[model samples]
Target: MHPDGSIQAESNSSKADRALFNSSEARRARLLPSAEKKKRRMPRKGKGRREMAGSRHPLIEAVDPLAEIFYRPRTVTVMTVGLCLLAWFSDAFGLYGTKFSAENGVKRGLWALIGTFLAYSALYAPHTFMIRPHPIVWRIVHGVTILYMLFLVLVLFLDADQARHAFKYLYPDLGVALDERAYGNDCRVFTPENTSSRFANIMDTVLDEFVLAHLLGWVAKALIFRDWKILLFLSIGFELMELTFAHMLPNFNECWWDSWILDVLLCNNIGMLIGLFAIQRREKYGNEWVGVSSQPTILLKAKRLFLQFTPETVERYEWKMMSSPKRFIQCMTLAAACLACEVNAFFMKFVLWIPPRNMLNTYRLFVFFLMVIPAVNEYYYFVTKTGKEQVNKLGVFTWIFLSCTFLEFLIIFKFGRELFREPWPPLVKWSWMAAGASTTVALLIWTVSRRNKLKTQ
Candidate 1:
């Protein structure tokens, strides 16, 4: 009143309300779990975050800050209703009518089936070892892989002509006989003009376009495998495979220099080196990852954002095949499976009359490339990783891979029976037997050595 601002006294109700609120908050804090309470007490950034992450399993990747959006609950009810409504409006009304042939009807049905399967996959596909690049990508991988497996199974049921016709329906240009000889007919015998024509041979081999494909394919394999020993085994194993199958599939027949030098030493080795070099760079520098959102510069953030699909980390692997008999068998099985995959690709092409130039061939290879990443990762963990982090069962991707592998073999054996009827060279048979005996001897030696080492210990 006297032009002076005096402080007001505290209201009793307000004082009581403040005290009550503080007491309630204290109660809530006390009721929390010890871990939760500790987490809440920790600083939001730096050491606290590092501790939390360090406590988690290594297989669990860093969750994107935006990952909550992707975790929203999904249901098939809406999708199912939409499908029914579309079918009712279109099919029930006989919009297309009987103008659709039986073949057209079947094709449409197949397309619908494939679409449904893919939708299910996107919504419900099982997770594998790979979760980065978005789980949706791995879902798509699963969908495509299972579809490929079914395709292989379907091929087994059909005769060669039937399979050819069906495949042509999809690709249109495939059903023609391809010249299987990769190095060409000139490699059959050494002539003065032929064997000496190194320049022409290199040009021919390089120009075939498959050489480039092989180079890129090996690069991908190296990255997926991330192990030089495994890559070397596959490279040499495939060469021996080519030798064994050369009598039947002429494409495997190549000049000694071409097989060992051009294909192996040049294309495969170069690609693998490039891939391994990339891995080295990533391991050396990219081992530490700053959050994409945490980057100070826009350009750096954008670069990190773009590279989100790349591997979270690149760590080299040591298969240690000879560590023990069990491990040796496992490693050999894995390598053999890889070799089988390569054989399946070639065998399917030859049997189904799909030429190497066909888009289907390219697509098949691309599928294999995508699939093997998760497959190998899963298999590695299954065999090696132990205790709580161990994968007790084969993962979805690995199962799909094995299923397709064996299914393709069955298909080849069933449809290509006539090819097998041809007399295989006696040398090829004896050589394979010798290889089996050698592997057996090697396993026994390892077993004996391990036993002796245990006794000494």
Candidate 2:
């Protein structure tokens, strides 16, 4: 067993292992439940984490448990041959430079692009991050991350107008100028004299389409943090962030009740409750993975199959804010990163002239949700690791997330300058500067105090 409660299975060497090739996702079947009460340990356990029995890539040496038969080494022979045949046929027919209707060409190009991405996902995509449900799912996610990064790079080359115009190739309806400021700037409270009408207006604002999005987003945040304390910190901190940036981003201009009551009280609380419920339920499982073929009943088989979508093992978190100086910094950094991601979501749509309902925004947020599953797990691994583990580098998902965030900032900076040219309000500017300085000074003071206490001990 690895130190973090995950089991590693050997290749098909033993008689038991032949019926099981289930090491892909840090999960193993209870194949030999009858063997002994005390299980045998890996020979390499004493060698430490530094000498993990794999190449530079973490899973390069591990085999997929889902696939039954495979070649000695991984190869894309099928894709190579198919590509060559298509090339030869297109060359012979002189269709390489052929042009068709914009509609037909775009449709075919989009299909081809999807096919290419699938092929890449299957054959060449990195599968080093998430391995739950299946490795292939995470491989597809990695491919999407790469594609999104390349897209940002491509968009960066075009001017704001040119970039927005290019959306016509895919999203033809987005040719119009952006209309920012989703909610109106009416920050009025419930008037006691006119309670009935004001209550209806508040309900209308609270029950909009975006409310569902907020609920789901907070659910994801709850899953990432798991700890209620951290979740509460992030939930409250994000609203404060929206307050700080309300002057700049008009959508951030929400009523006091909308920000504190509806968002923090309603959506955030409910989402965290749901997500934390899931975590609690997951912790109750005994980590017993019986093979599908061994199931006795059809209903049980369906249940197991559906449960495959869940995690192989539940990892508990202890993200207390005042744990240690390093722990405090890590927790705050994670909260800051989550808040930055939230801000960037709205900021990107406004700057790129993309409508709030655009599929681009939806897919971006969905991919981010998928990416964070592994990113949080990876970050948790980094945080809980001891000196014996020697985990000096960030995992693949965290790197992908950080890279995408940087690219997002680049895109916003490149394009937003042309759109939002107004100066920041003086109060907003001074408040942000003071907040930054105070946070820095407080952190330094806390760290020094902790260091002195440790020395006295």
Candidate 3:
């Protein structure tokens, strides 16, 4: 009986040992390899994890280059080329009959073509070369353009007839008829009783003309920044700018409710917001700008097909959000540009005696639209890209600016003959001019200072 009891205890001990061995083997199997080995196994995942850990956010994947070509820069190029082609064909076909004599026609066409070629070469040819200079040259070019525009404006005041004649020679079909008798009292004078009508007219002008212009501006901003915040800030800042300059331009001065509540906060601000929203939605949803055959409904598919005909290409601008100082300066410069453009438009019209819907006005506006794309693109590349500055000034802008300034001068000299006859209050005129210059300088200095501070930080 004692022998049997000792054998049973040994058998139980053996069973316990086997169970312990199995438990230890299970724990060994569950143990993980070192992190280094894991990283080696999944290199991409490891890199992604490291990036996320180091940065504030994960990096976005690169967008396709083809998708980006549809946006502003390329579209503008396509449009300009199309226009030039159309103009060439139209000239060949006599679609718009030439108003000039045969000898004049040949001379004018040759000169205009030469001028355009020179302008185009100056603006675009530098980029082809391997070495790029700093943007200071481009800025100088822009300054020249501005000076030329001023010259055009001066010419308008000095001799409207000469300005008109020049246009006639350059673009005979679209030439201005200098005979005031032929135009026949087109300029409608405003009166106290007609104030309401004038105001309504201005409102219509803002909506029909300026709204579209502003929308285009938003599109330009979108193409440059690619981010919503910058667009919104710029749009808002512009309205403030108009307000600041209101005292100088009667057209700018408006009812408080109209200027602030409606114009600034509502129309301009809402337009900007809408543009930003569209950009964000496009980014977030991913622009699957494909064909509409996959649409659930035939009607929807048909609508999509129509849209495809008017397809707008999306160019995703890769943006690195600028520091506050840089942003402020950029916004201020943009506002100044806008103001200068507006002033040019008004002064040109006023001095030239050209009605709003006249061919001259239309041509000016169209030419400006064409010029802005290259100018903005060159400006952006200079501002953001490293070691790329020697972009040339767009020929159209330079020409327009010079021509407009000359026209303005002609008008001032011609019409203001009686107004300046007495030389009344030279001090006041000097003071006003001095103030404008000072303001411009101050804004520029502030911008540079802020940029420098941001760089140091």
Candidate 4:
């Protein structure tokens, strides 16, 4: 009906409208795919909430992946290799002995100072570079450092005269008792007329120094455990241990009153109570330790400033509260291990004919304490996080344990001529040891079972 040109124009307009509609539909489809992609990539809020809920502890949140790597078995193996090489050279050649001469004492003192500084620097320097994963590890290391320092101070006191002489040469009127013979001479003051008095004095001294100190140590253990029942069990179990082993060591042979009253009731209980009080206080108030920058107010700022001036704060770790029963058990088990360790020190010195005051004995103790920190940390990690029952012990702990047992046997066989002269009746000693071990295990199991029952109720 219309002209040919008008028809063509109408057809072109229809085609253009259809093309635009197709393009709009394609755009809508493209946007739908993009929206779906976004939903898939984004994490759901509920999932995030669950992940956060899973790890509730602040300590767990603070763990560094790098620290976990550094603490791996391979790294520990390498460290063990290095320490072994050092031990071999030191023991075989007596490298340390050469530094102890009169002429070299001044040099030795200087070197000792430098060596100590370097050792501490090495310990602390790593912290600056790396974030410590385990707070307990830091605490253990710090505790070991304190023990080592205490041992060194005791040794210095033992050789007070030599130390004083050395100091006199360096500076006059130091007025320090380098060789006072306070402990050694007083300890050896034995007489026939004063036999009863001497024995009483020895009892008193042992009670005050060793027994009381250890009882207090147990109290510290209880504070760490934060449970009264476990504390009671540990206190009793340790006494039983002493009783069981009394025949092996003359030192453990004490009067009943001395064992029960002085050791258990007075020293042990007091220490445990003090530790308990400390724990309660800490739990109620919470720990107040803050980083240097975070300390508030002028007074707190001043306190932190003062702390920096001394070596007191150098190895300090941020204190944390432990809640898990697993953690509590781990701590107690480690403490038990430490008891064995302490006994090892005594046995090694006794069997080796090395006086307790000897430098070698002091050095060994210091070294052992230093080694225990890393060892215990590794042990705690393996047991707790890794779900491992048999944790790898640090070389130092293993060495100390083996050395103690071996030396004990060596002394019994070689030096204890009279003690072993009479052959034991069939199965007497072995039976006694077995009975003691069985009793210990039974008591521990009963105690744990009772506690669990109480908790459930």
Candidate 5:
């Protein structure tokens, strides 16, 4: 017998007593909420935010219980509510517009930007209630992407002038603005005098808006393709693409030096190198997937928040290049898709007649850039991981992106009938160049793969 008048166990382990105590504790823990179970000791007066495990401030404590139900931070909920109120009050106060006059460029641009922001912000509500469980911003971004794709679909039906009118209707400033400077301005045409001024011409071209635009395009392409060889092929292919379509699109016609040296060699290669370097840096350090949810530090959380604007992962893509018939098909398809994307860029500008600097153009380009990150990931999976029929099921974003690409072509074809009046010989020649270039690159990659395999063996 124990001093407390309880029966003492005979065995040294006291197994029965231990089990009874554990069961009682377990029952108690089960009855209590997690917060109560691991309740933190309150800080005494004069203490300034002392270290305490699992301790939250009274404000945080009150908010967290409610936040758990919504799967969002209290701050996000509060900001969303505040922003909604602000937008509503602003509209009521006639801040966005005094009247519904379509001619007012300021009103139109303001309303468009405000409306888009509000619509995108409103997406958080549905995301909270209906969308799959994810970070609120992530879900909102996905919603915005869907809406953007739908917008592209709607645009596909509108004729060229109608589309320009649509842009003007949205923002009166965005009339069919085109920079009409002759691309082939030098009539001497590669004369010794002209050739002597090549270096000066290169310098002048470097400062040109179009040159910078070309570089920017290559940057996006490099990030998407993630292969120097592939990007090089694309750079040359796009120059040929420009030459092929120059008759239809006046902007495509540039001097030979401008096409090969300035655009392709200088701007495109530099942009690709920059993009590749950025990617390499990301891979070198950012591969360790520290889930945003698990991070507790404020700085890390902020970093994670910024990263929502970028891809979640940065992996080096390896193309199998002719490893098998399926892979060969995928390689060809990738090249074709890239070429289509390039063509879509130019035609979108041409068909819409929106200057590169126009806000509408900028917005579309920015959104499309965001769209491509997901599309590239999905395309890679479809091409490499999945079987034949299985590859048919594309990710949501990829499907929308492909639809947009096709619609862009459709819009160009339907509205720009006069543009398509170019002779078939050029198209045939362009097709052959595309095929030859892609084949040569594919074979080079195949050779590299085979050599590497032989070395491994």
Candidate 6:
């Protein structure tokens, strides 16, 4: 009986040991999956390390910032709203009565508030609507061009005095701001005796505000055409334009030296060379030549920030307008469009009584500069592409550009009826000049094509 009891006790101990072993095994089985999961989650070497680092560091993915900015656009939008609110409060209420007279303060405050809101709206409107930055700029540019067209259209319905009232509404001191200085003052006919005075006056004109405007205008033309020949043609054409319209617009009158030397040589020629040089440099160096974004340095970031004001893209334009008759026709159309734009610049100033230094004139110039970038791209596509692939319709910006040009002409006709009462003769002259210019351009293009073919032969 004692032997039996000893065997039973041993069996019981064995059973307890088995039970402990089973429980431990079950616990390990439950923990095994978790351990494996941790193993899988841990980052590995090489690619995995890079990915992990990128996920942790925002700057690592700075190359594609638009994507990141887009993903968390709500945060950006909220921040903009908060800052605008702060500005409004600070301007309107915080310093309203203390720093300025109540009426003046409130006026300034409202301007600040509204301006801030508009500016923010302009910046984020594209983001909210799911468009890219360059496209956003395109849209803004087209919008401004269209706005100007509509404004001019509105002005077309108003008489001269009513237009003056319109200007007064925008600026109360419009009359006082208007420069009543007559053009061609003290009309100095070219004489050898008065050569010194004439030279002095021409030199003075060379360095005046209009010189910068002329230079910039030529620069814009250079960027548009990217051809020295076409730039030369346009430069000569503008001098002809000034001569053509001088009888109607008194301001178009200029000395021979002023037109050929001061304008064509000093301003237009120099400006075109500078602009073309920039284009060449851009081509040689590529878009990332500055390496501003790639450097990941504070100085580079600041440089890139400043460069945002420059062209978003700079592509080398090889105009093959001489390739076909259709292309030649398109080029002539472009010349006409360019001439019309130049005419509009002068007429708008004359009609609106806006000086060179006026805010309105500056704003118009800025908007036009911005507008042409996209418009020219779209126009080039329309001109180059053929048949099924060609864009048959004008893009929004291009349409706006043409419309604005037409409206400017309409404005001049409507407002300057007295000034242009004898427009028939000038109109006839312009038509003849335009025909001659087109013929000259076509001949030049044909000559270039013939030379190219000969080289190929």
Query: For candidate 1, what is the lDDT?
Result: 0.72
Question: Which residue pairs in candidate 4 collide?
Answer: 160-178, 160-179, 161-178, 161-179
**Candidate 5 per-residue lDDT over residues 1-457, each given as its tens digit:** 1111111223445445434322323323332347863576566753333323222211111212212444333545566776677566447667677454465645655655655564555433222111112335434556666667667788877767777788776667775557645576653333455554645555565578766676777887788879776777778888888777777777777788888877787888899998998898877653233334445798976675455355434667777754664576676676767688768877787777777666766777777776676677667656765432234456666776777777777887887786567575766587888988987887778778878888999
What would the per-residue lDDT of candidate 4 be over residues 1-457, giving only the tens digit for each residue? 0110001112556445534422323323322346655465444586455433322222122212223332222434545665566455444477565444666555655544544444443333222101133323443444344444443444334332343344344345443322221222233335446756756545555646455446656665654445565556566766665665555555555556556766677777888788777655545522223334445577866674453332211121211214344554555565566566556555444433444445655566555544553454344334443322333433333343334434434443453454324554455578778976985786677678868988999
Per-residue lDDT tens digits for candidate 3, residues 1-457, read 0010001112456545534422322222222245654565343565455433322111112212322222112334644875687477448667777567787667766666545544453333322100112122333344444444654554544344666556555455533433222111223334335656755544544566556765665655554445555566555555555555443334555555555555566666566666566666655632233334345588966675454432122335433445444644654564456455655665455444455556766666654554454454444443444332222333334344435544544555565454333442466567668977986787688778987988999
TM-score of each: 0.79, 0.80, 0.44, 0.44, 0.64, 0.66
Give the clash total for candidate 2: 0
Q: What is the lDDT of every predicted structure here?
A: 0.72, 0.69, 0.46, 0.45, 0.61, 0.61
Candidate 6 has its poorest 10 consecutive residues by lDDT at 1-10
**Candidate 4 or 6, higher TM-score?**
6
lDDT of 6 by residue, 366-420 (tens): 8777667667766776777564445666666677778888888888777777555
* Candidate with better lDDT, 2 vs 5: 2
Quality of model 2 by C-alpha lDDT: 0.69
Q: Write the per-residue lDDT of candidate 2 for residues 36-64, one digit (tens) a residue.
A: 42365536655333323221233223333
Q: How many Å off is the CA of 288 in candidate 5?
A: 5.1
**What's the TM for model 5?**
0.64
**Candidate 6 TM-score, C-alpha based:** 0.66
RMSD of each: 12.8, 7.8, 20.8, 21.3, 13.9, 19.9
- In candidate 6, how many Å is residue 246 off? 0.7
Candidate 5 segments exceeding 4 Å error? 1-134, 176-179, 187-200, 286-313, 386-392, 425-457
What candidate 3 gets wrong by more than 4 Å, as runs, is 1-161, 164-237, 240-248, 281-327, 386-457
Q: List the residue pairs that clash in candidate 5.
A: none
